[model samples]
Target: MLPGPADTPPGPRLEAAVAAVAAPDVVFALSRDGQRTVRCGGTAPPPPVPRERLRYELGSASKAFTGLLLAELTRSGRLSGGEPAAALLDPRRRTDREPITLAHLITHTSGLPGLPRDFFRRALPAWHTNPYARYADERVVDAFLAYRQRRRPGTHWHYSNFGVAVLGHALAAATGVSWEELLTRHVLLPLHLDGVAPHPGPAGTDATGHRRDGTTPTPALDAGGFQAAGAVRGTPEDLLAFVEAHVRPSPTPLAAALHAVRRPVLRRGLGHRHVHTMGWFQHPTAYGPLYFHCGATLGQQAFLGFCPGTGTALVAACTRRFRARDTFVATAYGLLAEP
Candidate 1:
């Protein structure tokens, strides 16, 4: 039987912190001091949100899962993180700027810019529609090959959707399996997380991503070329479950790989300082050292974080595009810190 809220003590303070933010849907789940698992907001009676209906877009947060998959592939000897990314792709199809490694892709230090310069310019008119939806895989690959580099690989950290997309391609080539299948088999299935899916568009119950104005709904994300970067969708409860597994993980290699990804690679700055480890961001918090990640698309906002010290993980998903301002992260940390 599913555990009830009584078995899982609620973090009222965390709930209040989320409430203060006025987020459309907030889900705080904690597993501390044994089998305790408490959920507030999303699943409560007179529910702030319908538990089964709200599907989060996951934004860049999808990188964490992709990172885990890559780590697993490396652990199994199917792929190597140290190898240059160009080695996997056709040389004629790769950019000559510099050697981009899988590690650089995972760490977001590959010197690749965040997004294509014309991505917005070209896609803005259909901004609410899934712009990348119509672009074929060949188009995505061509964009990468045609693009020029702004800096040397591994010299600095700049989040790049294209970099991760390349990693996805490499993983597929190495494993001879599609990225979606790899994620489903290696990550979701092992964790028994049936709620998570590569593309939420076909899932009739998935939540709709509303524009910033909250009046119009955006097209469901196109997973064709963006699956590795930001295409997964799931409910807040499922996300919290995934975090719990990370906190007190099993002794298997998958769990070990997850821990390996959390190791700090680069110093981002004080409380807000960050280390872009495998797929997640490591940051210090009042609750103790925590690994967190937030994602934003044109029409959605999502935050997923877990405090290992307290065995607490909180996930907040909203329909409208919310700014990833300091206040957003601070608010999440505040909820996680409450005892």
Candidate 2:
């Protein structure tokens, strides 16, 4: 496990690492000791791009929030992690696929595919505009129920966007409320994460995510039914605060829920040694247990991680999809894991 920074302010080393990343714009935040330091850099960036104010699509990092919501629900006894999802979903629409539990979906071991095949069929037609915007909750649930699993549940670790999305629907079905409302009540409201939203409002200026070409505008993807899988966007300050909550427990009433999600659930061999938590991918490094996850939209990319033992968290979001995003993540990990 990486040791906690010894009262050392993140200095040139961190900046140089981010500078080496190939993105049109990048915002990063480090949280420790109840304080956060945010930094931003880019070439000819548009207005409202300050370190604290810049907003980017969190991509799969949003899954952590969904996982937290699941944990919270379990703590409240509203749902059981081990119960069959068929209990929550409508009976008429249930699929022939093997019965899965809420825990299976949260841990990505439900054997579901990353997306329903029909999702691509619907999305490809409007590839440039917004593939996900039209997929409402009902549609997502229908697609999920009709699909077949490629593997047996809990046998192997496979990440599935469809699994998480179905989990969200099940939660909503059990609660009789929209998934957004569930998230707002259980996580966002308690955390006071005002800047986090499923959709970008006209009031705030968002950093435009650039296409892989680095010139074209990235398609505008919406949360729709996959809202739980990906679709949250937030300012750097808001995201940093979210990470801070995981670094240490927040004072919110949902503290138990927050702590519950961080508990390591299973181990996986993903090239690097990794322990999968409810949402976050966890690793034990020489310094400490590293909890991390990365996100990507059609254009934007995001990375977030923290070590509980060290009380250090790294939150980075970038606009402009590029090949070096992985390299940038490795560099950030190297810096954070340093002694």
Candidate 2 residue runs with Cα over 4 Å from true position: 1-8, 49-51, 92-98, 270-272
Worst 10 residues of 2 by lDDT: 1-10
Q: What is the C-alpha lDDT of each candidate?
A: 0.69, 0.77
Cα lDDT of model 1 by residue, 1-339, tens digit: 122233334655445554544444444445554344444342123333464346778888888889888878877787778867665566455445467778888888878777666666766666567776655565566676666667887788777887787778767766678889999999998888788887764545676666655556676777557678888788766787777777877754378777777677777556536666788877666556788788876667777877788777777676566554534456665555554
In terms of TM-score, the best-performing candidate is: 2
CA displacement after TM-score superposition, residue 64 of candidate 1 (Å) = 0.8
TM-score of model 2 (CA atoms): 0.90
Worst 10 residues of 1 by lDDT: 39-48
Q: Write the per-residue lDDT of candidate 2 for residues 1-339, one digit (tens) a residue.
A: 223455556755556655766677877677766666666675535456464586788888889989989999999998888766665787565444557888999899988888877888878876776777667788888876666667777887778888898998898888898778999888888889988877775644677877777668775557678988998888888787788888777676778887887888888776646788889988777667888888888888888888877678788887777675365577657655654
* TM accuracy, model 1: 0.84
Using lDDT as the measure, the top candidate is 2
Task: Give the clash count for each candidate.
Answer: 1, 7
> In model 2, what lDDT does residue 21 have?
69
